[model samples]
Target: MAGLDWQGWLTIGVVLATLALLLWERFSPDKVLIGATVVLAGSGILGVRQALAGFWNPGVLTVAVLFVLVAALKSTGAIRWIGDWVLGRPRGEFAAQARLVAITSPLSAFVNNTPIVAMLTSAIEHWSRRSGVAPSKLLLPMNYATILGGMCTLVGTSTNLIVAGLVHQQPGMPALRMFDPLGVGAVAAVAGGIYLLTVGRWLLPLRRSALQQATETREYVVEMLVEDAGAMAGMTIGQAGLRGLAGSYLVELVRNGELHAAVSPEEALRGGDRLVFVGATDAVRELRRLSGLRPATEQLFKIDDAGGRRTLVEVVLSAYSPAIGKTLVEATFRSRYNAAVIAVARHGTRLHGKLGDVVLQVGDTLLMETDAKFLRRYGNRAEFLVSNEIDGAARVDRPRALVALGVVAAMIVANTVLGVDILLSAVAAAALVLLAGCVHVAELRRSLDLRLIVVIACSFALGAALDRSGVAALVAAHLMGWAGSDPFWTLVLVYVAAVAFTELVTNNAAAVLMFPIAVSAATQLGVQPMPFVIAIMMGASAGFITPIGYQTNLMVYGPGGYRFSDYVRVGLPLSLVVGVSVLLAIPRLWPF
Candidate 1:
């Protein structure tokens, strides 16, 4: 063999560097991509002028804007409102929770899943308190639904958008439509939903939560007098329906003098008995109004507001934090942080805690209740991961929400009816939303994850380097040499490789890396390049292996209380099924 060119050697070095970084998990994939770009630019494999390609990639811009859109919906409390409806509806406990996943999954199809989970976690915790359902019962469904919903459209997930953009870049490639994945993806997603509803539920590792749902929502040690005519005077605890309080629960009952914290739900409640209810002040007010009761004048027990401005915060537990492997009781978040963790969501499992001793895991989301400024004060500490709350502070103008909704709708309609350039329409719509004051310029940056931006930038530069170095063609020729005479099997293998690579790296990176190979393979096989290019695009969009493979997966991971294997258990099989589905569809839909 002849000596390799400088570009070839540089390409080999780049690939080796990537492999070493990934093997060690030494840095975020974003860092890896950026580093690759810098290396290629320095080596002259990527033209200095081409280095900016990723910043302008339509796929990157689409994902960024979609993040902002989802953020806007999240800030509006729309997702939480949906979660509230799902959790509060009168239905069988499991059935109601299942309905929550069903609703959330489809909503994810239209919007991004991460912000959806951030908004819904709070609502589920609220339901856990009022309905006395284990938070563990609801969080898994939330995660599954988001993944399922991501299958609805090309823009539903960043991976899909990246793949679509890749196909658009190919000289002979066909342009993908908005609902390009609707047929196969929807079928797989719905099937995935069914899997979660039945088999996957059984496979989840159920951890008993630390927070026990008391008879009361959250008991405030308030004193109550036994009145002859009061509703509690003649009734047993079971008959009082203490759990039905809108915002609280009655956990302890005090009579004339004796205190009881272990009262059963079925215990009798009698009037004139000094009782203690673990409830918010407003709930107490409603209880008093409905029961016609008087407040105790003498201090009976310390009554703090039910979780004092209960807020849902997503906290990333850091490695150096005191909470790392310890339970809440051990961490003393209540005493130390002055916060009550109602639920802990990690991966696909939800662990409930009673402000007691539930050990924490890295990346676990503590569904907490505290003063608004309390957690914000400790946000920079090492103990907790960065937190994001769906802030509904901006006074939402109904007209603004309506107009924003209208713009997004118009863009979608235009794209579908007239085949308008989606990126152009969407960019215009985003501008309109900004001009209408729906979103400020300063807030836009936070909406999109910078990880995605870096990944795109790196992938674009890498693609250019591959084109310049001719390394992609060399690899593709070798791969094609193994195909022999049958074209169908080669195409299937190509798709499979793309999907596999996507599972290990960012979708744009997968596309950029694989597209050059796909094009080269088509040339060697003497076949239409469209089939191979489309196969790569389809495969790159598939992210049904690990939660780390996709941003949407990570979004739901901490909130779902899922272990790494939960996705492998459910997603691996679905991925295999979808792989075959794509293999069958691509040939028929776009014909070689």
Candidate 2:
């Protein structure tokens, strides 16, 4: 502090303020990081070129391209297909946990773990209902598994790519290979998986899920029709995956004008059969994703011209509407409003029977399927009081799923085997998917996570400031004084610091902030920088003690009915297990 210059003090202040703002959750991460970059560049602490260089970094561009690739795969249903194939019916909780770790850990190595977790959360909820297992027991472990898997490959997580990009910026440093972290990551993953399957399983709470709680309050009645050429036509109700739906139950089945109430699980389903379900709103939304089943109303197909580009919206009927007293069929609702009503609810009471036969009421809430533009078109119209589009409701293109899968495989081969750069490989894959019609340009634009890209690009300025202002070296000197300058002890301190920063800030930010300190520490010890680099990468992703530590953790917090203590109860042990394994393995793999 005595010898510090103005630039060093300014950089330190900006970094501390950034961490405080992020932890306070006052603003979005992108906004906070961008503001810090502006401050540094404006104060002459960093040049304009250095502040904006992150926007053009190879790692940042690669992350953006990968987002498009993941969106294309999701739109084509390839990721869901893989999940279904690998998660074939497990008998019990332990067996389910084992199967989940096996599939998610490996799959996340090749693809981004965030989308993988997002898609699987719903799938796991369905499985929990069918197997009579509480979702709270499975969701947290699944989140941890993805985080562990992400440590295996460079493309597995954004943190790894950001660290690699930093490494590439150094003089005389070789680029990191795809499997550079495999030795230590694989060992840590194995150790973490074992703890989850045994001790962590016992510690998980058995609280009711959010869907289960919602079922107790509000319920909606909806009907789904089986297609003549669909896969579920000849199967029994149980075999068709409709036996024990979570927060929903089958009321009856109608075939050729014959009514059968209290249908049995063994009852066979036939083409053109109407199955009535009474459940919560989430259950209805989940039913929409099932193959071979559609809303009973034919208007659903007639309203949206864009195939696989529709969303579910909730609209409340107002007294000024013309169809308040007439039935949906009599009012010609589809032709009049360009939307089809799939389900209706009135003051916590569930309506039953065919959607067309139901008479519209002034206060009834209607769940309709229409094009994405329906909200923009009719948001202000007096025909509806309130209109809101459901999130993650877009339809998938099953026909082009295989084409999207092929494109992803080709991208991996090109990067790992053909010796092409990852940025080029990702660009080519994104282009191929667009050309093959697996995902539309508009849909891709809507799905791209621009906020995440901005945060990654803007964070480079903070890292560069720390280096140029000598703050990183000053911190490294203090760390060496405390650790007695022993390479192993210094490595431990570096790893511990990274883990702490990640839990307080974010994974990518922790990596960027710790990169300069790690390099300075390695230089002071006269050791290869590779060990310290790998340590930072592993520690930054080992955020398991808190939900806010990782995005995936927060994603499951509500759905799993988890409290903050639940994470500590289950995650603290997992953090130690992974930490010990990584610390021991890094030294042997890349000696310091």
Candidate 3:
């Protein structure tokens, strides 16, 4: 107390205000953390190098590189393949959850959980459509599974790597190994997994995703031809994952000029077989992305070779349109506009027969496959009243999937077996992915989550301010006083504080802020700092009670259509299970 200075007090105040703003949701976390870092840097509490050091931190750079690596995997269909293979044809919801947790946990152990969640969210949604399970039933469990998996390894989540980086800076403190947390983290994951699969499963509400809840105002009848050499050519309808589609149904299958209505799930698909589907706009959009299928019209091939640069555009025919009364075949829509009408909807009515025979009318909405430049060229044209590109409808490079997977595997081997640093391994892997043409440079740039990286980088500045200003020591003294010289109780207090901070702020920021205090507490007790450090690492990731607590939680929030109380209902108990398991295991593995 006697050593406390004005700098310490200012850092404390700034941290409190930052936390308040974060909890208040007044601004994004990057802005809040950056604002606090600026204040501390301006006050000379931290030098420019220290304030900006996080940007160059190995952990932060590794995170950025991993984003590109994951993007490559996603772009090349490696992730979707993994999901489909692992989550294969589960009979019921329980089996689905079990399979999901089984795969997500282990995969998340190596990859960053954010992109994993993002990629798998869509996959699981599509799976739900086919399996007759509600997305709300699966998304939360999957999110939690990723969090639990993240705890088992240092690279599993950014929080663990950030803490390890902070530990490396401390004199005499040993750096964390890849599997240092495995002892406690594995136990906690098992316990948490059991709870989520059993009691937690029952606690989840049977809800629909935002897309499912929306009314289908524009139902389009789309015809897709099975490609002769594609993966789905010889597979049964059910085997090809076309059996059950949410908000959409197969109306008929046209084979050899014969119409097969009420298509059976066991029907075998042949090359050039035309499958007709009636679905809402969202469902149609998803259908466009399916592999082994193309728009049934030959006009699509006549468009200029956009190749991977093609996108889906939705436009409403205006009264002044030249082909308002003409059929698409007569209008030569593809040649004139350099686009193909994949599907069309008129006044919410399902148009039957061939798409080319449909007469264009005023107010008809046409979903067209066109060059990426379509929107910019036609946005203000009188021929269309509305023109917009469908988001997330990009061409996937399935051919390079194996290359992306191989690169990831090599990176893991280099990092874990060959004694290379994770940042170098990640950089090499990302580079290899680009060099192999798994993902384009533009896609790589877009995949980097700058907001998350900024929040993490700026958080290091706050952590530095806490350590440099002696606030960490002061807080350590208070923590010791609260624990009354008992190391076990002191460990409990540190873990509790970490969990509170994580739930209130964020996983990365919580780990950063708590690192100094955990180390200081270990120092004041004359005990090994590793246990306290491990406590902070595990505790910071145990945030399951609030959506705002974790990025993966928020990612599923809208898609799952969950209430805030939903997390409380299921996550509260799961948190207790994980916390108790971690607290009991940490002291044994890394003895104080």
Candidate 4:
């Protein structure tokens, strides 16, 4: 250690500190990564060019472009159609898991898996209620299936592109073809899919969510108004689909300044009647979408722009929320937040009153009708514990769906057949979507996950620091020495190392750090680097053992009501299956 150069030791110190912070999980991943990058650059361990190089990396830019493309797909209803078509009504939980894996596996091979999981998570949450399946039983498998599928194609995951970019930096290494990892990756996907279907079902626990427990304790009391022009006008309560709504029931009907309690199921609903309901959040959510029904308060109408587009957002009031202790009307919530509360639910408590008269309280979950910018505007504020757009809140533009699909198809062809550079093709596809109005330029800001982009870009900087400071070479040499002359053990070591590190850090960071080591290890063994490269690629994505390991896993963690150990129980076996399959298949496909 004393013999090591200052740059090498500084790089090692910075990396170790960054790892400590990431493992602590006290701060955002992006903040921790960017902070580390700045420190390394400021300390003179890395030059400005090297520290900032990741921002321009093809992998980072490509991922940014893909986000726009995905948003376009979602805006046009293309993703929704694909999800519904692929996950058609299945009889039971096991059948539903099979359907999801079958569809997402192949779809992820061409499309980025993160957005796919994001798009599907909410839908699956909704479906879980309807089909009597626990989201716990479906979400983990859904996330894992996408990861396995991603392993099969070059463009499947940003991790693959990141690794390919590294490979291009090496002299004498040929650029990777689209399906280079397919043979091994597909086999592993199939093996893991089977294991999930057979063994994972029993391993995953059936746990009700906190929201569910809250609902069971007490139902939210909400008021809805029947609009004059809505098809629901003049229908009986029973005929309007308000009777026996899942998790909800009509409690009162107010019309012409008259209050009718214990309203009969057969009571006819008249235009402008204020119907009161007691139900769970899910039930309330369904009620909000009912045609001709509007929130009793007129503020909801104000959220609609001249373009007539509206989005539903969930805002969790914190101690700092301005509306705390103030009634919605008093807060002037419409003008204040630029959003209108359609419904409000306090955990395990129910309130009775007109919508506007109910005073806001800390910990209340307000469902607002607003635009996409709502997330960006209040997401980082201390006033709210959470501010996020509700997935599937808006109607799909079915007319634009085909055009979005065509643009995506052209992107695939341009990269796979026409040999256009992946980054350029992605940009061109993104432009086509924007120009065609699949996704408007105004919509792009919130559509991209800046945290994801920053983390990837910073990971590139860290990788550069590792390579330039010789830490990467030092680690690889020691690893090769530890494994001796055995190529098989060397490959397994690389894979195992990646999997272990990924559980502690970002998936792309794990891949970035391991790529140089894998390449060096192959060079030390006097063998082709492709096998080790493939091993690193597959292993970096194999983050099933913990929620922190993969972005998709974390995305579903809270929503699915999953504990940390839940992942180990179900994911361990699948990880083992994938590990064995990759080891056995990699040598044959990309021989050592």
Candidate 5:
């Protein structure tokens, strides 16, 4: 065995520190990753090019392009339509989960799972309300199903592409075909989905939204407008999906400057009509996203051009605030604060008439759609007791919806059937969407998730350092020593180790770091590396036990109001089921 060199020791130390700090969760993951990358480069453990190569890696760029493409699809309403159409109202929660699995499985195979989850989060929430299912019950399944779906195809997740990249790097190793991993991946997904539907549903945490969480404040009053020629225009209140909404009521309607008290459910809505609703904050947020309904305020339009840069912030009035004693109209919130109030929540109090006429008081929580700079400008001010930005909802562009769908279809066909390079196809598809008016040049920058991109890029440096310094080989030798020379058991060890690392680190990082180690173990055993490689790919993406392990898990974390234990309760078993399924199927499908 080779003794540990200085570079190997340094690389090991850096990797350990990064893992420790990540578990601490005090700093951003990107900062920690970049810091480690710089350390490896500065210590001469890795060349500058090797350290920065991740930034230009095809895997990283493919993920970035897919993010933008998904954004175009989202903003154009393509994803929403697909969700509604495929996941038709099911009679029960189990059926709803099954429907979601059916829809997400196929879609995620062709698209990246991050945007697939992002697009489905809201749709699932809405479905839960309409179908009497808890969002908690459905959301975790949605995330898991998407992860499972990603395993079925080479282009499904960035992790798969990273594995494919490594496969291409090894001399004499054939490039992975698009469907090379499909058999094992598909089996695992189906088994995992079945597990979730039966045993997993009972284990899901029944978390209530913050709005409904407190009995002291059961509801809040808000207003919405019927858009011109929208889904709700000319429809009676009963027909506009305003009736029978759980824990919500359409209280009144204002039209032509006249207040119509307790407007009958039979009254048809017009473009100019203002509808008053009494509901929990969660329901009102869902209302904001329904097709053809918008906030009644004209101020929201002023900042719509900012693209995705705008966010929703919760601001509480303080006793000393200048706006506390005045109405929102009198305070000129849009002008003074550079934000528009979308909704307000006050304790057990009923708000009457127009939102502009409501008098502000200390402790009133205002839900405002603010500019990117709003939090920085007002976050610390004594005038507001609290100013925190929350997740803003996605908006749809009806005009460009079909164009986005067409571009996605073309990319899938060109890559899978026509044998075009996946990266080239993705780039072309992204370009086509932008030119076809599905997304604008100005909006393109906002679509990228820079934090995810940065972390992924830096992980390449870490992976290279591990490989070049012989640390991966050292670890593999030790692992093989414990596995007793059985290649199949060694494959299981590789998979379990990858899964452990994935739960601790990011999925892409886990895959990148494990690829060399898996190959080394296979080489040591004098067996084919494809089984170990396939194991790494499956295990790395199966990060179900924790939110930090996967982006999609965190995406649904806050929106679903999930506790950390919630994920563990449901995801732990799902992970085990997937692991066993993958282990049983990989060797049969591809003998070592």
Candidate 6:
């Protein structure tokens, strides 16, 4: 250990930095990880060749490839095939929704959750509107179901892979066994399902929109200055605290003659960049005056074209969303998919007027309109959250259903059965399915969540540090001492803390920081780590208190006209219910 080279110390330091940024919420995890990689590459911690290894990290690639498979399901309308399987015999609004949750919750075990939400958002909206049940009734469950699904498989979420990867690295440490946490996750999911059916409904926000324009309306547009500002000058919208302006938002920061790459929450704002803020008409106007900014575009609001063949709406992207951190240009959103972006809102910043140059990122709200054909054609191209609730039947493409099912199935089989890493299988399946004409090559680009890539890549670097820096091990040791030999207590400490942390930062970030602690705890107890890990996976999804917790919740917060308390009112109970469920099931499935 004393003889470890500069590369070892550098690698360890980089990983420690990754954990610090995420755990402390000091800086953007993506930014921290990317910077760490460059630094580590320079020090030869992972070697010049291995430094880029993160780019090829199976977890990162699996997430990206899964995007394409999900897109194919959405594009081909194969997801629709499964709709009947879940929603066919709805007992009532509550029961039907519960059933939907039950089915989707399980499927998420095999795949990621963003596409599941994208595939369902419209359908749920349409179902609620048609049945006269509030969409608030279904959405919380949708988010919960997807989250629970993520707990079932290692490849389901990047968090799981991070845990598996790190644990495997420790000498004598166990690599994750298939279905190790399945029992615990299933129990948690079940308890959560019941809780959602019961107390969860009371906690959800009620929001529905009949008019497309009213729903899609860009909040407000204001102009901000980048002149001589410290952080703002070098910062992007995300980095400039502009995205933090939740209630009111800034659209874009205009610099001399050029729009920035994308309005990332982590992006640095540069001096002389004219910032555009979009929020409530009143808030937008007021913030402009406060910030000494002006409007870059005239009044723009959404128009309801749902009744007609054409429509306009806004979409908020989830962290896992394929649309994270890519512009319409790279995804060819307009030409290939045939939709136009009239404006974009990254919380406080509003991207309007010059749409073509704007790069997109997760959590950025997009305002656009197109005909039914255009939506139908391009809907599967990008994984965007419904910033504005959409009104229509969740469209289906029967021709693409087989492709979707086969590709997804092949991926799962490749990972679990064939001993291939899930990511490799997913990439291969996506490529083969697309080349085989199941999905278009163009669709692949549209489905990637590039920002997520950045986040995952960075998280991996952090995972390295958690192990090397002795931080994760230390934390685990502490928790084990406190929780003692009680498996229940251990689960409580790991799972409960995971839920709390995720609500504060991103889930991927939360897992990276907490995983080492869980590993350490397992070591202290001299018991297997599976049960404790199940706790983290379930806990990360427990962010139900505020719109800020999960991107899904944030996407719905304003759109639902939900107050911060609304999440607490509903999400708290759901969190507990899920928590209890994990306790009951994990012991059985992965029995410590």
Error of 6 at 80 (Å): 4.7
**Model 2, residue 258: displacement in angstroms?**
22
> Which tens-of-lDDT digit does each residue in 384-430 have in candidate 1?
43454423232345666666667767777877788887687677777
CA shift of 544, model 3, Å: 0.5
lDDT of each: 0.62, 0.78, 0.77, 0.76, 0.75, 0.61
Q: After superposing candidate 5, which stretches have Cα over 4 Å from the reference?
A: 214-399
- Using all chains and alpha carbons, the TM-scores for the candidates as numbered come to 0.70, 0.73, 0.72, 0.75, 0.73, 0.69
- Those runs of model 1 whose alpha carbons end farther than 4 Å from true positions after fitting are 1-4, 82-90, 93-105, 128-142, 208-312, 317-362, 366-370, 373-399, 482-485, 529-534
Total backbone clashes of candidate 3, pairs 3 or more residues apart or in separate chains: 0
Best by lDDT: 2
Query: Model 5, range 181-242, lDDT digits (tens) per residue?
Result: 89999999899988988998889887653322322332455578888889888888778777
lDDT per residue as tens, model 6, 19-72: 556555444556667887778656544456554555666556656666777767
lDDT string for model 4 (310-410, tens) is 46565556544678788776886766766655556553233433456678765566656555566556654556644445544535678788888888889
Candidate 1 vs candidate 4, lDDT winner:
4
Cα RMSD of predicted structure 2: 13.1
Those runs of model 6 whose alpha carbons end farther than 4 Å from true positions after fitting are 1-29, 39-53, 80-92, 167-178, 208-303, 317-384, 387-395, 410-428, 484-491, 584-592
Compared with the true structure, model 1 gives a TM-score of 0.70
Give lDDT tens digits, candidate 2, residues 495-591: 9999999888889999999999999998988889999999999999999998778777765665566777888899899999999999999999998
**Model with the higher lDDT, candidate 3 or 6:** 3
Superposition error at 345 for model 6 (Å): 10
**Model 6: residue 357 alpha-carbon error in angstroms:** 20
Model 2 TM-score (2 dp): 0.73
Model 5, residue 1: displacement in angstroms? 8.6
